[model samples]
Each structure stands twice: as structure tokens, then as C-alpha cells.
Target: MTDNLPLAGRGCVVTGGSRGIGAAIVRLALAQGADVVFGYHSDEKRASTLVDELRAAHPDRQCSALQADVADGGEAERFATEALDRLGRLDVLVNNAGITRDALFARMRPEQWHEVIGTNLDSMYTVTRPLLMPLVKQRGGAVINITSSTGLHGVPGQTAYAAAKAGVIGFTKSLAKEIGARGVTVNAVAPGLIETDMTAAIPEDKAEFLKSLIPSHAFGSPDDVAHLVCYLASEKARYITGQVIEISGGLVL
Candidate 1:
């Protein structure tokens, strides 16, 4: 956050930054003195407001918003180009855009499966590929993928979502090995039952029941995950890579 902090002057790109976890990441990174560009799917109003707010908060730092659906390969590529162009440099990339089409494996439609994979899994490649050269050329950068605990524990009735997120875990590990030598680091953050609009879709009773399983008897917040993200993007974590760190208040443990 300061001149001595790892994130100072680093350029950051956060997907799905209009609200929830991605928004939190944008705010935290900006507060830490990182120039930030956040991507949104549809909510241009909120995205605009966030950019305005951040500009006010960090008057001297670079802050802006971009619109792109990481689900679409072509759009993802364009988004990366625009982000790099607008930010001038990119030192950290957060793959936080995702969607869920919940249904039992037998009931899940083909469209549902494709949508989940495209938005959650395929976007990792679609988005990251465009930035790879720039990151490698710059000599170093960090890539952080956001996956759910469902990816690890295999949640029932969310076959499509689970599979795609699980793929992110493997993708992160493999990509890390390929790019670490370039001074780039890739890792995945798997959150357990985080309190977000995504979780709000679940029935309240079911959400309460899940909370009981958390040792803290509470759901994790966007800021909780943001903390770990900031840490991983810091020099303190330079030695950490190719790992899937869970922040579930001991929910997964």
C-alpha cells in the first residue's frame, strides 16, 4: 500500500469487478496504491459508479472500468487488450468472473454445461492468453484464479459449475509451472460458502444450514478472500505459487 509495499505502483486487472468479491479486490488493491482496471459484464452503471468512487478515493492513482464478458473468447481477448492499453501496464490479473447453472447431472442441459465451462473455465485461457506476452515481456506478473470450494468437495446438483471450477484449480497449477520461470506466478483461491450474490441465490434456510458447518458459524465475506488475494499478490508471497489456498474460516478443513 506504500512505497515499500509489494503492491505499490503495480497494475491490477480484476474481472467481474462491479460488485461482490471482485469489487472488494479492486478496492483493496487501489487502496494499496495499485493502479486498477476492473471488468464487468452488464452493470455499466455500477461499474461507472465504482470507477468514480475509486478515482475520488485514490485521486493520484490510476483507476478505471472496462466492460467485457469473459465468457466469450473473443470478448475476453479484446478486454485484455483494452485493460493493458488503459492501465499502461499489468502486474496482477484476477480471474474472478464466473457463473453457475445449478442442476443435477442428469437434469443439467447441454447449454447449461457449456455456459458454465465457457464462463468459468474457458475464460481462464481466453483472458490469460492475451496478457501472457505482455506479462512475460514485462519480466513478471501474477495471475490469481478464483474457484469455489465446490470445485474441491464436488457439490451435488452443481455438476457443471463444480467441474468448471475444478478445472481452474488444475489449470492454475499447470500454468504456474509453465510461466514461473518468466517471473510470473499463477495460483488459485478456493473459497468456501462465501456471502455473495451468488450464494444469495441459495435458499435462506439452506444457507443457514451450511453456515452451521463453518467453525466460525458465519459465511465468509468478499473482503476475506480479498485479503488473501492481496497477500498472494505481495512480495511476501513471491515464494508461493501453484497452490490452491482455501479461505473458509476452517469450513473446508
Candidate 2:
């Protein structure tokens, strides 16, 4: 965070930012001059390495990584508390952390359902409840929740995952209404089908077919969503809120 950069003094938190899209967001934010804190469940070696790398680039911008299972209510609360503490005040909260336990409804175990819901849906409450106020106190702030296209339109064998993501969409819209007057904006990004470790396990032929369905004929990058996030967090997006923006290469249309 050199003297001339914008977003230099802003404080931000990115959950599950150790790898994939979350990590990409971390890098983008750091480069844009925002001091950041990222939350992780484990793999301190990887997490610490990322923090070190970002801090190296911006000595004045602080970066912290905390180990917390976003699925656990207590851990989520603690993560939010310590994140705000590290940054002093939070201007942005990106709920980019999620896990998928894909299974057909007929054979989906009860545990699969719970894990997906707890990690994906219930987590919204756990993480945001603790930090919502600090952002409002800042006079204005942004809350970005990461969702999926499968959630918007059901997919086979992903009942649990789809349900959880759909829950995020609904929750964010309602919260937007509740907080509109408080200077806090709530929005959700429903990514259609981007390449990530979660989807790396997907069969190649299937991936190709999915890509063909998309008009762009290509997968989106993490930087794609990160750009939207950066804009929404900035003064440029002051008038946009309660919207569920999709980044699916025209897959829905």
C-alpha cells in the first residue's frame, strides 16, 4: 500500500482465501492497495505462505490468516471478531468460502446434507452476524456472497450443494432490504461454471459438455468475479445492492 494507491486504507476480509477463487481474490485485493485478512480451516503452511507473499508486496498493508472452520458457528464468530480486530474496521466482507458434498437425493447421506448446509448456508449467519455492524459503522460497506449456477437451476447429484447456494441467494436479498437504510449493501454473485479445485474432480467429458452449453465457449477466471467484487466495494457501486449478479458466460440466457 504505497501512498498513491486507492483502496490502500480500506480493511477487508476474505474467507476461505487459501486457494482457488478465494486466493485469487486475496491477490487482487492486495494489489489494489487494500489491507486484508483471510480465514482458513487448516493448511497453515499454505495460508501463511500466501500472507507472506502479499505482505512482501505491500509492507504498509497488513495481512493476517486465521484458522477457523466456517461451518462451525463458534469458529465463524471468532473469525469475524478477530478479522475486524486485525483490520481495526472492516469495509468489505467476501463470503467466498464453501464446500460441496454432491449426492443424488435418493442416496445422499444425512451427514452429506448437514455438512453442505452447515458449511455453505448456515455459515452466512455465523460469519456475517458478528461483523455486520462494524461495516455499517464505517458509513458504507459491501457484503459479497459467492453462489453457483447449479443453485439457481438444479443439477443432478448436487441437491445439497444447490440447496445451500440457493439459500445464500434468498438470504442475501432479504438482508439487503433490512440493511439498505444502514449504509450496508448485500449482494450475491452466482457464478455459472468456473474452473476450480471443487470442479476439477468433475469428469472431463462432462466439463466439455457444460462448456459447450455456455455461449462464451470458455470458462471464467477467478479474476472475473474479483473484478466485480472490487468495483462493488468501491464508491462506483454505491447505487447497486440486493442484486444477484451472474457471471456464467451467458449460460443462463
Best by lDDT: 1
| Each candidate's clash count | 0, 0
> Could you tell me the lDDT of residue 65 within candidate 2?
96
- Which stretches of candidate 2 lie above 4 Å from their native place? 1-6
True-structure RMSD, every candidate = 1.3, 1.5
lDDT of each: 0.90, 0.87
**lDDT by residue for model 1 over 1-253, one digit each (tens)?**
2787558999999999889999999999988879999899989999999999999988989988889889888899999999999989989999999988899898889999998999999999999999989988987889999998889988789889889999999999999999899898899999998888899999989888888889989998999999899988877788889999988888843
TM-score of each: 0.97, 0.96
lDDT string, candidate 2, 89-198, tens digits: 88889998998888889999999999999888998999999998887777788899998888899899999999999999999999999988988888998888777888
